[model samples]
Structure formats: C-alpha cells, structure tokens
Target: MARVLEVQGVSKRFLGLKALQGVTLHLEEGEILAVIGPNGAGKSTLLNVISGLLRPDAGRVLFLGRDVTPLPPEARTHLGLGRAFQIPTPLPELTVRENLLVGALFGRPGRSRKEAEAMVEAVLELTGLAAKAEAPAGELTLLEDKRLELARALATGPKVLLLDEVMAGLRPKEAQEAVDLVRRIRDAGVSVLFIEHLMPVVRALADRVVVLDYGEVIAEGPYEQVAREERVREAYLGRRA
Candidate 1:
C-alpha cells in the first residue's frame, strides 16, 4: 500500500529544551505500526505534530502526498485523520447514543443531519456501541469507556487512526478485547498507528514496531527483532551484566 501519512525531520521545542529532534516516520495504508518508548521520549509530541495539535519547529507532515503541516486540527480531521486521547474523556451526562451522535455529526462524511445519523449508527454497530447506545456515557466500565473513545474517533470518518495508550488501564482480558477492536478498525481499511507500553500487546498487534528513547528512534522492526536488540533492551531496561 502507499504511504498515507509522512512525517519528515519533525522537531519541537519548549523554552530551551527540545522535545523532539529531527524525528521522521510515516505509516502505510492499512498497516498497524506500534510506537513504544519510555516516558519523556516525545512519543506523544510526535503524535500531536502529525495530528496538527502542535506545530513542528522544523520539518513537514504530508497526508496522502499533500503537505498538511500548516492545516489546523479540524482540517486534519476533515481530511481523514483522527485520534483518541491517552486519557479517556466522554460527555458524562450524555447517553452513549447521544455522545456518539456528536462524533458522527462532527466527523461524518455527510453534509446533512440524515447523513450524520446514518453514519453514527453504522459506526456504533461497528465499534460494538450499538447495544449500549442508550446507556449514559458515565455509566460505562473502564474497557467500555476506552472502546467508546475509539468509537467516537472512528465516527469522525478517519482513514488513519492514531491511538495513544488505549490499552493502558484495562485488564489483560480487556486489553485483548481492545486489541481486537483495533484489529477490526484496520480490517475496515483504516491505517493504525498506536503508542503503547505493553510488550505482549505490541507483539501481538503490530506488524512493525518503532522504538523511541529520549525523543529519537532507537530501533524499528518486527517485535522480536526489536526486543532482542542489545541497545534497545539496555535503553529500556538496565543491562543485567
């Protein structure tokens, strides 16, 4: 598949500190790329820059072969990029159906109310939220909340989905389910770029892994290859010897 998102030599600065330094990466159409890094590695910063939440001090972002680094967040969303937050936040007072409606209304490919509702209903079912549509958003369990967050992002009609730590707070079984949901998202033809700390989940879900440490890519490859790298293991975990 062709490249759907390209980030080249991206950098960001705060005060005198650099959060990212000449980071470059991209995602292929319908591929799942797992990004793993220790804290403060600028993983989230990279995601933000690609999604248009943070502007890069240097470099450019291209979406489907077009420069989009100058575009706003909403414009990116409108152009088939969507993201779920690391922390889940839904409208507590809104019913699952109603909250989903908001995503559908704002993120759908439609220009009218009827189109929005139809799109929302389709995604609600796809994300397994249809059964709980009438349930209040505040009434959901942790896993359910995570799924809802993903569902909302999908409702925005994104072809490239950026997921940050969706499996962070779930139980092992719940984590598996969340992983399954992401697989479904990819199977539906959307590309996935996920940031995660769980080694097993990354091993299971990612076609390839990208390792970041102190804001630079230390390694990139299949899970086993990366996990076996001496320097990568040392960077993430102190060497046994």
Candidate 2:
C-alpha cells in the first residue's frame, strides 16, 4: 500500500521542554497504526504537528506525497486529514446531523451544500448515528457522543483519520463496538493513526505499534513484538532497582 502520511524527523519544544525529539512515523493506505506511550511521551504533540495545529521545530509532514508542514489545520483537513478529539464536545444547539454537516461543509473546500449533506448522511449511517440524527447533540449518552465524534470526523471525507484516545471513557462492550467501528472505517478506505492507552484496543486494532518514551520512538513493530521489548516494558514500568 502507498504511504498516505509521513512524519520525518519531527521535533517539538515548549518553553525549554522537549516535547518531541526526531520522531518519525508513517501511515500506509488502509492501515491502522497505534501510538502508545507513558504520560508525556509526546503523543498529543505529534498529533498536533501532523494536523498542523503546531509547527514543529524541525522536520516535515507529508500527505499523499506532498509537503504540508506549512498548511493550517483547516487547510490540512481540506486536503483529507480528519481528526477526532478524545473528548466529545458537540454543539449544544445543533442536532446530531447538523454537527456533522458542519464538518462536511467546512472540511473540504469547494464541496457544495448538496454534496456536503450527502456526505453527512453517509457518515451518520456509517457511524450508526442515523437513529439519533434529529436529536440535539447535547442529549446524547456517552456512547452516542463517542459515535458522534467519530462520525463528525468521518463526515469530513478524510483519507487518513487521527484519533486521540477515542476509547478512553467507554465500557468494555462499548470499546469493543468502537474497535469494530474503527475496522469498518479502515475497510471503507481511511487509514488510521491513533493514540491509545488501552493495550487491548491496540492489540485488537493496530496493524503496527509504535512506542514512545521521553518523546522519542523506542520501538516499532507488530503489537505483540513491541509489547515484549524490554525498553517498552521499562517505559511503562520503571526500570528495576
């Protein structure tokens, strides 16, 4: 499969603290990649750089073989990068469908209102939000809110989706459902790069796993392989005395 997204030698710093150091990773077409790490491993910072929310101190972001390091978040969205926050904050006044319509219309430049609405409908069905389409976004239960977050990002027509701990607050059953939904998203032609703290979710969904420590990649491979690495274990659990 083609490499749809690439972060080469990326680095970020904040007020004299190194948030990321020469981090490099890639997402292939139709692949699901997971980024796992201890707290302050720079996962969020990496996502921000990729999504164009932050300018890296060094390195470049490439999407579809084009350099996009200079693009803004909305510009990157227009170019097929979609993102869902860990927290779901839907517009209180808007209906579920309306919230999705917002993503569809603004995410892709030049998408007509008719086309945007069509995309919204497709996303609602894909994310299983059709039943609650007319309901106010603020009224959704936790699971429904999570679905809406994923649905809104999907409505943007992304070639690659960036997920930040989307499974954070779910129960086991709900997380399993979300795992299935993510698989369907990949099957539907969107490559996924997600940060997840749940090892089960990573093992279930990731084609490859990348481990980070102190903002640097310590290991990268299949889930089980990376899980057994001494460095990874030590990263999660402090080194032996």
Highest lDDT model number? 2
- For model 2, the local distance difference test gives 0.94
Clashes of each: 0, 0
Can you write out model 1's per-residue Cα lDDT over 78-139, one digit (the tens) per residue? 88898998987899999988887787777745548777788789888887888899999999
Global local distance difference test of model 1: 0.88
lDDT of 2 at 137: 97
RMSD of each: 1.8, 1.5
Q: What is the overall TM-score of model 2 with all chains considered together?
A: 0.97
Cα lDDT for residue 30, candidate 2: 92
Per-model TM-score versus the true fold = 0.95, 0.97
